[model samples]
Target: MQSSAKTIEQYLLELPEERKSVMNKLRNTILENLPNGFKEGIAYGMIGYVVPHSIYPSGYHCDPKIPLPFMSIASQKNFVALYHMGIYSKKELLDWFVSEYPKHCKTKLDMGKSCIRFKKMDDIPFELIAQLTQKVIVEDWISMYESALKR
Candidate 1:
């Protein structure tokens, strides 16, 4: 579910006790592994990691006022979701993640185009998520986003 919390701290505090640790671990995993040049903040009502406007001045095409969103993590009504733009835009990355998922978690991969839904929070694979976080650097994401925009 979308959150009204202003800061990541606030967001975390608002989460149910059951979700707090999991979301924190997931957030920490991403923060620790995310390549430099990406900033963390609340975006689109979730915890977002973005390529800031200072780095890519054009900002997001859909809403130029905001930074270019690369990834976000949200606690939904029934599941915790990790949204990575790279997997949606890069076919190779998608293939890699899909292939690696079963090796990491027993649950079938529950995913949308970019959103990976973790219904069974206990089975969340932090290691695989860390690897995925490191796979795309800010420069590459900017390039991929621009290329798609031109298409």
Candidate 2:
């Protein structure tokens, strides 16, 4: 469910008590592994990590006013969604994650191009998630984003 909450704190407050711990752990993991220059905020009604305009003044090519998104987490109706832009935009990363995730995550994998869905905390591959997040630094991502635009 897309929350109307304006801040990350408010967003978490709106989630059910049962969901809070899982979300908080995921958030902390992301924060701990996130490369420098990614800032967290409420975007599209979910908690988003982005390359701020100060670092990438061009902003998101889809919408320049918005910052360049790197990742996000959302509480959806059926599952928690972890949106990984790197995996979606890069084929090699996606292949690596898909192949490596099952080794760490015991549950059945549920994922789209960018969205990794999990019904519970146990379904999450926290270690792989952290590794994936750490793989791309802000400058590398910006270079990738810019290259894609030229194509």
Candidate 3:
């Protein structure tokens, strides 16, 4: 999945036709709803965004520039994935999602402890996804990162 893309736009442009459409839609949705200081780009051969360590200096996950929180969109041969790091840091948010998600849909949200996997765009709850992204505000994430520097 090594992208030929030199930039995010190139990344989007490189995707196969159908995947391009879905990924672009999702990318737009996320950009529209994203809290300030968050940004979108490519990482690990996927379409994703990272909270840069330049802002946090110590990256919210510790190790500063070595590791940072990311939300990614993966277009595999079969399915698409909307993935994020926030699910691992906050229990309240996870609890809310677990309780609310199953109440509305019969199929499970194919998510792990942190990752959310979706085969199709229609399978995702746009509002829920938006809120989940919203939960980790930039200030909070930066605070967590900056605190790591103090330790």
Kindly list the per-residue Cα lDDT of model 2 for residues 71-151, writing each as its tens digit: 999988888899988887889999999899889988878988889999866678778888998999999889888888899
Off by over 4 Å in 1: none
Best-to-worst order by lDDT is 1, 2, 3
Query: Which residues of candidate 2, in runs, are more than 4 Å off?
Result: none
State residue 1's C-alpha deviation in candidate 3, in Å.
4.4
- For TM-score, the strongest prediction is 1
Candidate lDDT scores, in order, read 0.97, 0.90, 0.70
> What is the lDDT for 111 in model 1?
95
Local error of candidate 1 at residue 95 (angstroms) = 0.2
All candidates' TM-scores? 0.99, 0.96, 0.78
Give candidate 1's whole-model lDDT.
0.97
Candidate 3: worst-modelled 10 consecutive residues by lDDT: 58-67
Find the candidate with the highest lDDT and give its number: 1
Worst 10 residues of 2 by lDDT: 120-129
Better of 1 and 2 by TM-score: 1
Instruction: Supply candidate 2's per-residue lDDT for 106.
Output: 82
Q: Which candidate, 2 or 3, has the higher lDDT? A: 2
Point out where model 3 deviates above 4 Å.
1-4, 59-67, 103-106, 143-151
